[model samples]
Target: MTTILKPLALAATMTLAFAAPALAQDAQPQAPSQAPAEDKTPVTPEAWAVHLQVTDILQHYPAFHSAFQGPNSFRPQATTGNTVDATLYAGVKPWAGGEIWGNLEMYQGYAPNNTLGAAGYVNGDGAKVGRSHPYARIARLFIRQTFDLGGEADDQEADLNALGRRRTKDRVVLTAGKLNATDVFDTNKYAHDPRQDFLNWSLITAGSFDYAADAWGYTYGAAAEWYRGDWAWRAGVFDLSIVPNNAVLTSDFSQFQVIGEAERRFTLGGRPGAVRLAGFVTRGGMGRYDDATALALATGKPADAALVRHYRSRPGAYLNVEQEVADGVGLFGRLGWADGTYEAYEYTDIDRTAQAGVSVSGERWGRKGDTVAAAVVVNDLSSAGERYLNAGGLGILIGDGRLPHPGAERILETYYSLGFAKGMTFSLDNQLIQNPAYNRDRGPVDVVSLRLHLER
Candidate 1:
C-alpha cells in the first residue's frame, strides 16, 4: 500500500502543479448548464485543432478467502496496479470534405497480473500489452473523405475523431488507415470512453463481439459510412494479428475480419436516441475448444490451443442502444453473442454477454460538470469453452486452470466523477465481480479505483 500511495501522490502533485494556473483562471465560476452549446459556424478549411488528455487510474482489491487458486486465477492476496496514458489528438481540414488526423499516445503501466483471470477485466484503458516504462505509439493516423448529397446540413462537434464543421445529413464518408474498429461500430455514448465513463471492458463494449485488433486494441483497417436521413450504414475490413492474441499485426491480410453495422436515429419523448446492430466475421487460422481439449486428453498434457489450429471462420454479433431519458440522464444497453466453438481472437473470453446501465449528469444535484454512472454485465461461455478452461487452456484474457463448477461471470460497476478544476476531474470507482473467469468455486472479488483526468 505504501508503494501504491507513493506513485499516486507523485502523480497528483505533478498534475496539480501543472493545473494550478489554469484553475486560477477559472476561479470566476460561471453558470452551469447541461452543456455549452457549440458554435454553429464551421471552421476554416485550413484550420487545425490540437487537444491533449491525460488519465491516471489506480486500482486495488482487498484480500479475500479462496477455496482454490490456479496459475491464471485471481490471487486471494490484495493487489494493486495503476495505468497512466496521455494522448494528443491533432487534426486539420486539408480540403473541402476532407480531414487528416493523427493521434499519438504515451502509455505507462500494466493491468493486474498482465490482465489475466477475469472475463471483464477491471480497466478498459489497460492495454493488452503491458509495459513497465512509458512508451509512445501512434494510436490513429487516418484520412477522412466525405461526399455530400442534397439534404439539410448538421453541425459536427469538434471531438477526438471529428472536425468542427457542417455536413449534409445525407453523405458518404470513407476512412482509411490505422484505427480501432469500435470507433465506428457498436458505439454507445453512455457507456464508452473509459477516460470519462465506464471502466469495465464488458461495459465499454459487448464482451463477446470479438472485433479484430492487435494487442493495444488498434488495427489497420478501412471503413465506409453512408448516411441518409435518420439512418446510417457502415462496413469495414481489417487485418488480424499474425497470431491470435499476439502483439504483431498481419500485414499481408492473410488473416482478416469483416465488420458491418446499421444505425438508426430517432427522438423518443423529444429526447434523442440511437440503436445499432453490428456484426463481424473473421477468417483466419484459428483453433477450436473441443479439439484443444481432446488433444490434451489423448496426449496426457496441458491443452494447447495452437496445436489444433486451422484456417476457419468465426462470427459474432451484438445490438447497442442509448437513449436520453431526461435532460441529464441517459440509458444504454447491449446484447452480444459469438461462435462459442472457436477460440476467441481478441477481446475477452466470453461467448455470450448482456449489459444495461444508466448515466446521469450532476446538474440535477447542482454539480453541473460532474457525472455518475452504474452498469451490470453478465458474461458466459459455452460448455465446450468451459471444458477447455477446465483442461487448462488459455483464451484472450481468462483461464483459471480449472472449472469444476462453472457459472456466468457477473459484474456490477459504478463511478462518480467530480470536476474539481477546469479541465480536471477526479473519480472514484468500484466493481463487484462474481464467478470470476467463470469459475464458481472461486471468489466474488471487490475492486476499487481512483482516477484523475486532465484535458486541454
Candidate 2:
C-alpha cells in the first residue's frame, strides 16, 4: 500500500478545515424543558469532533540479517526481526467540553524479550512469534471518563480567573485495563525489538498499550486521574494476580496491586518550549503461593513451602525539556531515575539507575515544512546494586557489582518526513552496544537500521 498525497496545497486546505469558527467554543446557557428532560442527557453535536482519526501501523526491520534469532545457530547471531500491528485509535471532543478516547491494537510476528532469554545465556528462544493472547501478547481494553469536580461549568464565569492560574480544562480519566509499564527512563531506546524499534532493549516500551495482553497477565483494575492547571495525577488499585495458564502461576495468597503517578507540565520560554517533571510508583507483590525469593532467603522450612513474598515495587522521577531553536531546529532533553522491582516467574530485587539524554528535531534546509529528527539516549547503571537479567533464561549480572562490566549501550536515530505527504517517512537508526551483559568478552555490536513508515 503506497499512498501519496497532492503535496502542500492539500495539507493547507486540511489545516484550514480545522481552523473554522465552530472550532472555538462559546458559553451558552441551558434552555428550560426542551420537549422533556430524560434520565440520560443527549450530547450536543460539534464539527471539531470529526477531526479525529483511527490510527494503525505495521513494519519490519532486518535487524540481524546473518543467523537464526536463536543462540543455537552455530553460524552467528541474527538481529533481523519484524512486527505486525494495528489499532483502532481515536481522541476527540464528542461533547463540547468532554473528550472520548479508545484504542484496540494487535501485536504479531517476531520480536526479542530479555526475560525469554535469546541473547546468550538462555540462547534465544525469544517467542513463538505468531498470534498469541493477552497474558502472552494478544490484546487489552480499558476506558475513562472525566469532568469538573468543582462544579464550575465555564471559565468565563470562573471566579478564580483573576488568579492567573485558573484551570480552564478539568478532567478525571478512569482506566480499567492493562498497558505495558516498561522502564522509568527512555522507551525509544529500550523498547521491544520489532517494527520501528527493532533490536532494542525492554525497559523502553513497558507502558505500551496492547489489545489483549494475555488471559491472566493483563492488569484487571481501574485508575483515576485528575488534570488541573498544568498538573496531572493518577492512582489506582488493581487485581495483581497475573493471568496464569495453569495453577502454578496463580496467586497462593495476596490478590491485588496498586499504582500511583503524577506529572507537572509547564512552558520554559515565551516561545515554543516546554518542560515536564513527573514521578510514578507501583506496588504489591505477585499473588503466587510459592514465592521464590522469599523461599530462597528463608532458613529452616523447605524453600518451596516458605513461599516468597515480593515486597518490591517500582518508583521513578523524571524531567523532560523541549525547546525550539528555530522553525526547523529544536532541542530536546530528558533525565530520570528508577528503582524497585516486580515478580516475573520468581521474586527478585530491583536496583536503581539514573539516565539522561538529549536530541534535536525540526525542519532544516531553510525550509519551513521539511522535518528531520536526530536523537541519542544513554543509560547509567553503574550505581545500581547487584541485580539479575533474565539475560535470556540464563541470568547475567553486569554493573552494580553482580556480573561483568558490559559497558553501557548507546543508540542514535535519525528521521526525515515531508509534511505535505501523509503516511510517508524514512528513518535510520544505529545502536552501539558495548560489552553486552551476556557477551562481556565479545566487545561491541553495532546495529544499523533503515525504516519506511506511513500513517493516516
List where candidate 1 sits over 4 angstroms from the true fold: 1-46
Tens digit per residue, CA lDDT, model 2, 361-441: 222233333444434444433222212221111211121112333333333333343344554444454444433343233
TM-scores for all candidates: the values are: 0.90, 0.56
lDDT of each: 0.85, 0.35
RMSD to the hidden true structure, all candidates: 7.9, 13.3
- Candidate with the greatest lDDT versus the true structure: 1
Model 2 clashes, total count: 35
Residue 347 in candidate 1 has what lDDT? 79
Backbone clash pairs for candidate 1 read none
RMSD of 2: 13.3
lDDT of 1 by residue, 260-344 (tens): 9999999986689999998899999889999999999999887878999999999999999998766677889999999999899
